[model samples]
Target: MSETPITISNLNDYIFCPASIYFHSLDYYTDTLTYQDSYQINGTAAHNAVDSSTYSDNKNILQSISVYSERYNLFGKIDLFDTDNHILTERKKKVNKIYEGYIFQVYAQYFGLTEMGYRVHKIRIYSMDDNKMYPIALPGENPDMLKKFEVLIKNMNKFELETFTQENIKKCSHCIYESLCSFSRLKE
Candidate 1:
């Protein structure tokens, strides 16, 4: 297994295109190489409150807290954890569809917190755009989805840039690393 833990946030990107993660790791000056399109900008804006950790002084509400799962070797900051209700929520700028990637992210957070001795009653995806909440089943309650998530993690552990291929060409146009990726389907 790789010494570096898999980033929880990168789980979504991996589903989009594994190659994107490899290109993203390349050393490049942030200002010169990174592109912040409207979607990214909107996402940042949506996360500003949580990112700044400026939520009300309610002890039951935890925002922008880091979580790690030694068992899964995954780590990342979760958007919110409502201690009073034991609900973990991941906030997205907009959530048109409850993608498998999104579920995987919340599951990782759930597993991390549970391993750390926190009781997680539920997991959800909150869409800032539509002001909606989409609840997800717990890992034990959804064995099929859990199996898929496990397979994804296994694939990530074995990821190799040389052997990776872009299965969904349409994703390339939306990928930030398309300009740097040799497998990008977008025409220059």
Candidate 2:
């Protein structure tokens, strides 16, 4: 089988559970109940609105911009790309803490933009819930995180799992593929 493309979203699943990559690569998805959350629903709508909005070229905010990095073999859509200031703002519905995966994703975008010849000056995470912007400290090159992505990609392609445990029951509970994910350690 062909290898699956490593995406920015995979970082989230990898942080949650490496085995999830395997399931996702196989296309063995199940409609678990997590989508019913109102928060997620609202977040989707908000993202859609931002993505589809026909905002004039205000020379400040650009929404739903595509970014890619050939060096890291990853790509993703940035939520808000500030053109005038060269600041990439990623929007989240809510975040209690800035997780490693989030940092990696943002930094990857920064690297990608740099590789693409855009002078990305800063990166920030804008919490929609708090209506606040939290600046992210950019680390120029994250070989460790890139290596982790490589390992996960290799594991997924070879059907090799380093572990089969859920990161946490709470995370597994919120997973839409919980029903189909065999490695899900969520107890019945």
Return the top candidate by TM-score.
1
TM-score, cand. 1: 0.88
**Each model's lDDT:** 0.81, 0.64
- lDDT by residue for model 1 over 1-188, one digit each (tens)? 67789998788778878776666556223556557444323345556788887755788998888889998899988778999999998888888778898899899999899998999999988888789999999999999999999999988998997877677777887777777778987753
Per-residue lDDT tens digits of candidate 2, residues 74-110? 6776667777789887777776777666676677677
Residue-level error in angstroms, candidate 1, position 17: 0.5
Worst 10 residues of 2 by lDDT: 34-43
- In the order shown, what is each candidate's alpha-carbon RMSD? 2.5, 4.6
List candidate 2 stretches off by more than 4 Å: 1-4, 21-46, 54-60, 141-170
The TM-score between candidate 2 and the true structure equals 0.71
